[model samples]
Target: MKITSTKLIAATVLAMFFVNNSAKAQSLPESKLKFGIGLDGILPVGNLTNTANFGLGLTPRLQYGVSENVAVTFTTGIYHFFTKEIRIPSGLPGQYNTMENKLDLIPVKAGVKSFVSSNVYFSGEIGVALQVDNGGGGSQFIASPGVGYAGDKWDLGVRYENLSKTGSNSAGFIGLRLAYGFGL
Candidate 1:
């Protein structure tokens, strides 16, 4: 995976969001509604790394607290990857053409987060990833599992994501997320 300067800068900015919002974690307030923004570093692994390179993206989310320890969230994000062009030979001899690959991934998902401790939580989300510029397939199912810390108004988490078709190729990656929440 290529760790470009842009990716590092983005990751740093996202981390700052958490730090800035967490300035006063001495008291954790209870809120019924919260909004969050986050950044993710997408490292393609397993079969996914074979075709695509690393990616970076942003996620903005909204959550409604169902109880003191549980919340339901609606999330969406865009992840961009780098891929090489594909060359296909025409029927004519000595003729070849290239196809473009737009490695943009957009995922719209909804899930639940369960807080096991005051500062620790586990979450799962399911949705479809829309593959922009994919000729053969335009969409694939995605499932993500995340674990992280939660504060009165901020959070930090690590997540694993899977994107795939039932009988086709699959992609996996690990991502880090930092988010800030506001009480309703």
Candidate 2:
């Protein structure tokens, strides 16, 4: 059976909601602020895999608890995608030359995190990603959904991030983030 993207996303959200409802309730600090820095490893997917081999990112985030199990967040980050070498035809039959390409992006986002358990949470974010290149690149809209484990001082999460631009194909990646966090 073929599963569409919309269906998959809906299923994931539904599953997370069920998990949250079934898990034993835990208390979270209210009206408290926390800061975190995360290092990410990304694997290109969809059309992005055609050009990029892998990616790395650094992100800093701030979270403010609004309720016992919910928090609002702001995140900004830099991501660099390493591109594969491509061969270009050299104006002659059976002759070619290779060139390398790369991409850098900076993202600004706002999101919400809802705890499912004492250490598990589900998060969703939406924002814009600005491209950085010699050609003066443009920006794309970004949306990401993730699930994570947050401990006293360490957090780990996995997310699927999608970026869309006008007049171009959308790109995506699966990312894993390891973070260190503290109260502020």
Candidate of highest lDDT:
2
Q: How much lDDT does candidate 1 score?
A: 0.72
Candidate 1's residue-wise lDDT over 99-160, tens digit each? 86668878899987666656676677789888765662578887777778888778888877
Candidate 2 clash pair list: none
What range of 10 consecutive residues in model 2 has the weakest lDDT sum?
A: 19-28
TM-score of 1: 0.72
Stretches off by above 4 angstroms in model 2 are 1-5, 12-18, 21-28
Against the true structure, candidate 2 reaches a TM-score of 0.89
Model 2 local distance difference test score: 0.84
lDDT of every predicted structure (CA atoms):
0.72, 0.84
